[model samples]
Target: MSRHLRLALVQASAQSFEDFAQGLRSLMKSPNAAELVIYPELHLCSLGAETMSEREYYTAYAEPLDGPRGMALAGLARELGIWLIPGTVLERGADGAVHNTAVVYNPQGELVADYRKIFTWRPYEPMCPGRRFVVFDMPGTGRVGLSICYDAWYPEVTRHLAWMGAELVVNLVQTSTSGRAQEIPLNQANAIVNQIWVASVNGAAPTAQGHSLLVDPEGGIRVAAGMEDTTLLGVIDFDRVAATRKFGTSGDSWPWDQFRADDSPLELPLYNGHIDPATWRPAISPETRNDLRPAGPVVFCRPAGENGPQ
Candidate 1:
């Protein structure tokens, strides 16, 4: 059996934490078929730590996967009976290190997954990468995985998600203006290679650009909204994901399933598969292969590829 998921990507202003909460609560009240709702990265603040000290943002907005923001989102997801990816927040780990993290909540309001930004998009210095990657069952569909604003740039994340049986790759983003040409193709290529759906919700209005998009199986932009606030509802078919098998036999086959598991439990399967010349083309890698600053997800993730400062 396959599931068709209705995803709602929230793109609105972040006047304050209270404003964000109120907006989310009100939006969730609307009647829709959305099984899961994703908020933009750092949607809790307009300019996170820009004016306030990093210490202040950590104290005020940073919370554990068990803290206030996580708890509140948990209750909301349970109350509304919808899965929720509340996006990323700066969390202060016990070791005094800060991490940009995301939480996944089931409809029962139970926290099912927690993904720290494996590829942090920091301005001052590099933040430590999270330990690993993980994928979990998304109710009726195959699986769902988390990648934050910058983490989505890596093909490894989406490929790992698909290899782990994720039918949909959900990205919560807070993209600034003028980085579209780079990241758009990265997202589409990730979807096409891994054979799944990718829905990214971005911030809009007040300061940044809002570009919430839904990409389908054929690597086509099924629905898209520009740098303006608007919610789109799209169909994510599990069957499409299941049909992406490359080998001649579909049942007992996966193109990259045989990838050796690594000790980095968070490691996503890296693909070296040859592209089908008849139907596919290679993605531009000049930008993605280098340590480019926040150009897009792929380019953004190159820093991680080097595993050091740029």
Candidate 2:
């Protein structure tokens, strides 16, 4: 197959957890077609200047790993017969802690993988990190992995997934064009180093400056949109991913380590272990990397004795 699988990246502004799920179901009926559909990070809520209590309204929409929304997504996956990568959200536990989580559902309506956000940002404290990475098989194609928005910035996360036989890496992003332009390159490079397809979908319009992009393992931009409020549809060749992984004439050929995924069985229990939410972090750095870049806006910090708005 040569770049035949269609992909859809939804970039609309986020709503509540309930509305978000409903919205996802609605997108499936969109005029565009995709074998795989990806929602942006925090696909459940929008960012506002509001305080934590107000933000809690959004997080309250959070659920456990085995909650109703999870089942609903699984049903949607089954109904559409498409692989879906939902973004991170606040998953509350019985211990009164919340976690930033990413859940994947297969066409069969089963929970293929659920990855807790390893690297979270502010307002996402007391969440936990998933100890390991997860990869699953695509019906007629190769395997794929998932990551949250912040997780995209971390090299190890991408490296881990790439090493684990992932032909495709889907990153759900909820980024703001506040102070950085690192979004595209960071996700694209991850694909290059690992030789796989990388898909990143971010929010659009009043919520963000849209820049959703799809990149091939060779660092090629399959499709991209820079306009605000724009959404994009593209195709990726799953077969090429396998061919690219092969090591030419040398026995030491393929750069990918097949052993990385030898034991990553999706049925294994989540490593939620002794790890505490208060210590969890997003898979990537939430801070914008353009603090010193003259092309972007400058970030001014409050001093020890600022009296303007303290």
Candidate 1 is scored at a TM of 0.75
Instruction: Specify the highest-TM-score model's number.
Output: 1
Off by over 4 Å in 2: 1-4, 17-26, 47-51, 54-59, 122-126, 247-310
Clashing pairs in 1: 132-266, 133-266, 153-297, 153-298
Task: List TM-scores for all candidates, in order.
Answer: 0.75, 0.72
lDDT of 2 by residue, 191-230 (tens): 8777778988887766766688999867788888774655
lDDT of candidates 1 onward, in order: 0.64, 0.64
**For model 1, how does the per-residue alpha-carbon lDDT over 1-310 read when each residue is reduced to its tens digit?**
3356778877765547667666667777776448787878777644555687756666776556677767777887888788887777767688878777777888999988877778776574245678777666664354666777667787778765554445577787777756654677778877776767888878886455776788876678998877777777777776665445433123454444433233223322454454332212112122211221122222111211122111
